[model samples]
Target: MRTLLQAVLSAMLLALCITATTQANERYIVKFKEGKESAVKAALDAQGAKLALDLPKHNAAAFSLPAQALTGLSHNPNVEYVEQDAKRYLMSQTVPYGIPLVQADQVSDSVTANIKVCIIDSGYDLAHEDLSGNRVEGANDSGTGNWFTDENHHGTHVAGTIAALSNDVGVVGINPHGNLNLYIVKVFNADGWGYSSGLIAALDVCEAAGAKVINMSLGGSIKSRTEDAAFAAAETAGILSIAAAGNDGNSRYSYPASYRSVVSVAAVDENKQHADFSQYNSQVELSGPGVGVLSSVPMGTALVAATSVANHDYLAIAMEGAPTGIASGVLIDCGSGEQQCDAAGKVCLLQRGNISFADKVLACEQGGGVAAIIYNNTAGQLNGTLGTTVTAIPAVGVTADDGAAMLLDVGNDATVAIGPGNYAYFDGTSMATPHVAGVAALVWSHFPLCTNKQIRAALQQTAEDLDTAGRDNYTGFGLVQAKAAADYLALNGCTAGGGNNTCKGKHCR
Candidate 1:
């Protein structure tokens, strides 16, 4: 009987130790009654509580204390309340790299103008967090669906580049000051393809809606005379039309970008170099940041992935078509993942090459792997695709250096998180067209008296020249500069010959 009694006492002591250890790490806020702040603080200090913060304004203090002590303090007459110290996130806005590249960030955001900019593509996601607060209005010409619903996600991405609200979340657009009005004309279907007749009809909608700037992030090799005439007429009616210069990586002309009246925008990387996929022809009139361009997509539609090892985060790109999920397990090195070995319930760290990314991930999944990480075999980061193959596990890619670092902690715990987000990165001249369109509206808003022709000329004249000296086929007048063009109009007036053309009073637009 005495031995059994001693065993029960030992178990009770162990349980108490475990509970105390867990409670000691918990943080909470203790609010005291009026005139009891000093006394309550003294009592808490006597009990060995770790005070983190003092809030005399709120008559509260933050501390880490034992759960038993917290319960006792809650019953004290001097204590008003006790609450868990929940985490709070900063609702800050991210300025995309292209904003400052074109000098749009240097321009003033206080100026307001109701200059309408029309987007013609696969409709818009009107409910996006970054795009909801703007003065957005729409019209549907493609018959696929509603103008406010984005089926292909292309139009929503384009719209964000033009006027995503200056909200404290997601990303900010070129004209985020809520001055420019957006008019979306859905011409492309969910398949991301449309006929020239539909584009022409969309142009009509833009004209009727009083859109001074039209952005078309789409094009084809074939040119139609009717399409040509429609854009020509739109330009004659004081509308500035902008279009992508194709992504064929050739000198081939793509209409309606090849049309005489349209401003053909070519894609450039963040380094200001022409993208290999960006079409280069005599019609290529301007350049804008397009490669790896990050912008708003349909809410909860974009895939965001991250990988962390040993509590340190590493840049990771989710493999295209990979499943969305989160998994944490012991990191295991599975070379090439051609023939996985013993990766059960672990994250397979594979090296790039030997097979397609899909096959590698499939091999890992077959071996009971929870996740896969494929590191680049070359110098740069590996942005891989899974093609038509599907896998049940999440997979991501990292740079060669990061991969090497991850390999060092092979037996350590690692985590891979893949989920839907509100923004994504896309590459094409399709991405570049909106930057120019947004800048056109931003510059025009300041110079409301400037004619469409004058605004067009000012953009070309003040552009930062690149490639071979003056105008070239690859990048024409080079990268479009927003502040430079705005300053040009401030000094040269609305016309090329110089005239005083400042906007007057509240009737700016």
Candidate 2:
């Protein structure tokens, strides 16, 4: 998938820029902020330099004329960077706790039914039982076949976090039944980070592919003009883009995510504690869990030690001693939604939601068991169906009824062992991003007429205020309030008021 982003981006970069120029041609990039947009445009027009992408938020303009064309505009004052458009932002909040949803409304409103979303990162495992049905066809853009196969598990985890199907089988997505068209645009290599140019191409392909929303979970520190052009094109085309603030706990920002037009998000734990690793910036637009989040993993791989599920397992660990791997012990993996927990080895117990073969082994390993067993956590007769592979270690899955009986008969009651079910308790900023994405999909989906800007603003406006009275950096606009988005769209998006014409809430504002 990352390769595909590279291939397509290279083609786009070569696709002839608007005004056409070589470095020696001396075209000048002009930028402004707050109240200085029109003056620069008017003055630049008077100088005969063709107007390019008019980015209102940054007060920046792309000009294809020589520096001489900017004789007046340059000295007119208040302009920022006067170089090429730089793609210099990305996303990666630090908190690990997933927000605890006290009630399971599971977003009944189908705000995003037909809209397409492009996730440009690691590949997605669409074949997983929980995600298989909701998998968007033609979602893979990784020119490299390996892109569809999330080897690092980051892409699949990120993908599962964003649009895992909302069906009652496995994990519940924010927009449970939002009809979202998903695309996997891989911009990273197997290792997970990629050059800016690769991601730049992805923006073009994503825009061309008709994706209304784009989720960029990966990022870097350096800036690039190539990236800026891509972002401008997408915004000009009306695509709403969301990016993660870097994991570095500093006010300094990363590219693409830090870009004025992109939505910069931070991370908060389930306790609503700000992540130490999440960047603190006046520019951060909103926030969600970046800490230990429980999300889907690759089909055949074991989740790295940093997983939130692992953290949850660590929390209730009744380790007799720090014994190595459990060769013969009963282990249960807890989950409430329809998630795919694939564990191998012994006594693997499943949680709520859907069951995949991996769920059993995943639970067993986490729970330190040698063999494997899985059970349905749902209330009905959970026939205990999940995805699994035949292994040297014996493995079997059972219904919630059977597992509870077995646990009671064979195990002691000293530990805080969460019983059989598909839902596993996990946390992370990754988990929170999808909630926002799904809700965005729902709003954008229902109100097809709403511009990408309107959708973004609606999300910000409706976000349940978690911290401050209005908007604060910790919670940003607050918890992603879905109904607020829906109601606002129905009320505001329905009848077009001229426009909100509000400034990007930042230091100056």
Candidate 3:
């Protein structure tokens, strides 16, 4: 039986398709009044609350207090508000097109060991080869077991997009530099579910660990006051929060992301258009490549691959297995009325046009074709699925350029090989969120002196404005541009090109 995630992927695959934390430790954000530092500590110690973070900048501290002592801690005269730390889970990446689209490739040389970016989601896979040397030890789990391990693959994927190593194999991250160190904060469990308190605890841990940026790919419809206070406090402590603008394809807002304190990111495809499912509203601050993004998955999993073209290698997604390998053969165009073209024992190539993906593959199968390769007639790579049609021939998708090149070499042989180290395509505002986070890391790493507010301004002011010019709901300030933001920061110090100060609101977070 297919799980809900699998079922959702199936429906989206047909459309080109598709696409936390720990528990425990009664977490609370104890905000203290001015000059109440010693009193705050005494209250925390008296309540037996283990201090997780000491935020001197915000005059507050986060602690894991016993649930029974919550009332007493709240009654403290110096304590401003003691709220239960909320839980946030891993939102689930693709070389992801957003990387290059946002010009992250241009700033590869700006590596920094001092810039710590926290992925506050499902913990990470510490053993991931691509993430080696880029991770910081001593992950914060908020009392959840399994510490920094990513059982859900979502956190690992998000981590890969932000700072996958500059290795030869696997997907490269937005910031391929070796300097940016990733700190994992596991708030969600193996099931990808978490609470508000857990998230608050993770934020405390992030600030304590000296994380300059926090990337949250997960979100919920309901907003928690405790969660808002934590985020607001993190902002006050000079930590930039980036989040996904929901994936419901509606105007309804999601917490943390929709909060004014965090930078909300929307999803876009390779075509630089709004994704069908990406949520939109005034809260959306920016956009990134989120559709059919190809990136790293966990190790030992079945990795997808293909080898048929000469000059260029295409990221092929296997929709249906062909059982046996299809050796080189004359490519026959079996599109539209030409379904009868002698595809017997040959690799049938079809262009995405009038017929449905299933119909095209069925045509190839009917013609005795050993395999089928469908290339997109339009821009971007083909990501169509054949539903559940059990065709004897294997089917795969290729980019429009690769298909055109293959057409030019109609007589050349193509090969389809299935092996390990699988790369996948996923879609969501969750995927877009990391792109912005990564770009922010790149800029912040380049200019360590820039405050979190300045970093946010650089990103928003220098973004590639789309939709209705200035800042729109769908594309926000347009797609995030790493080099552009970096250049802006270097030249203007968070000031817009028009010489206007972009970092205005101190309480916007």
Candidate 4:
């Protein structure tokens, strides 16, 4: 991930709060008075303040103080907390962009049955509907082995995306047959924000647990000796640590993601374009669908939103209407509890779990509906998620919040349009990062013998170039392709894109 001149400076200052002990670059955070928001901002601006944001209720200005003025600003009565701001980044979300599991199996010859990927996010509800027996040995909040629970559902979503059961159950994860080892650190609070020390403790657990892949979806705006050593150790341990590129559309990359050692995963939408919130540049190694991603939630919960489930296989003409002119739509989520939805017109809102998005859409069409809108019932506002094998109707999505708002707005004359169209739809890079993580696990599982570097390379190298044609700020190595990655991984004596044997362009093709 990339960083801006302003963010870098500010993060250094804020890093102090978290005990960031890195000499890479000094950062500081300067707090100001509650009512003097404007004055503090203006003062920082005149001094060429790089980046600054109003602290929620603190009336403090957590800004990146210039090196020379740190002493003076820290002493100012208007200032409150002058410390390093850790660079917080979201965890990478991943999923299969193209090609199903059966197809993927055909490309590689190996057993992913034993690889135990360690998801280090919130934690899983092990008892989730889509994921259960698929979970292997692990640690969790229970303080005992083989027992884990996700108070926040984030870890559950990440876990399901990585390795939900392959059985003909609710949803098949990217690596349905893969073994997963969950390591719970609970760095993020129930609200999803924790102290730097908590993060370090989590990393300690991940490292000690002997996990193959550690997924970190939580991070702060600051970096500490705590995080630096943890990530560097992971790299040395030869374990793959996938991280999220921050959600701030700005180039303000977070730690671990920007730490140079971690594999920074960016969010690519269904359109195969980099999400507006996904960070970019050299550090962003690969890409995957991150908006409205579908995966298991807490409890036996199966959520429809994590990343916008955009992948859909159009079924043959089987609708009773014989369909004409209008693009009849069927969705897995109507953004509400009731089957009927009015986001735009008559549509069915498919309930999460037990049923399929396609089956629900087809049934809705049979029941006489013009369109469908599927949605996640999570905290944030998402529009839709990937749904395959649905027929006779176009489908879109909405987050639980927006969906509820629209459903509650019924009878009112107010127009409703939910979306990933803006900031509200954004809930951090976690929303978009799952796709990248899922895809990585899928491609890696395919080529069991391929070095982790090679798998990571195939993902980035064989991807279809989009957004800017060649590599650019938005989409890193283009959209992640399972077939391309699997095929590349099958090659012998392969290396990631770097040295002489690197794969790229038609040569990679």
Best by lDDT: 1
Lowest lDDT block of 10, candidate 3: 1-10
Predictions in order: lDDT: 0.81, 0.53, 0.71, 0.51
lDDT of 1 by residue, 177-199 (tens): 78778899888777888888888
**Tens-digit lDDT track for model 2 on 256-351?**
877877777777665666766677666677776555454555552321110011212212211111111212332444343144334332244445
- Tell me which of candidates 3 and 4 scores higher on TM-score: 3
Tens-digit lDDT track for model 4 on 1-509? 11100001111122212232222113455566666667666776777565555565765545556554555566667766676665553322233332242133343323454455666666667666557676465554333223366656576666666666666543456666545444555444355556666666666677777666677776555778767887777767756677777777767767777777677767765555567777776666666566535455564222111111122221111112121122322233343333433334344554444455555555555666555545455543333322335355444444465455445433322211111100011234564455556566555654444555555666677777777777766666676666676665555334543334444433432
For model 2, give the 10-residue run with minimal summed lDDT: 1-10
Question: All candidates' TM-scores?
Answer: 0.79, 0.56, 0.67, 0.53
Clashes of 1: 0
Show where candidate 4 strays beyond 4 Å: 1-110, 141-147, 178-185, 300-428, 445-450, 495-509
Give residue 502's error in model 2 in angstroms.
Answer: 17
Between candidates 2 and 3, the one scoring higher on lDDT is 3
TM-score attained by model 3 = 0.67
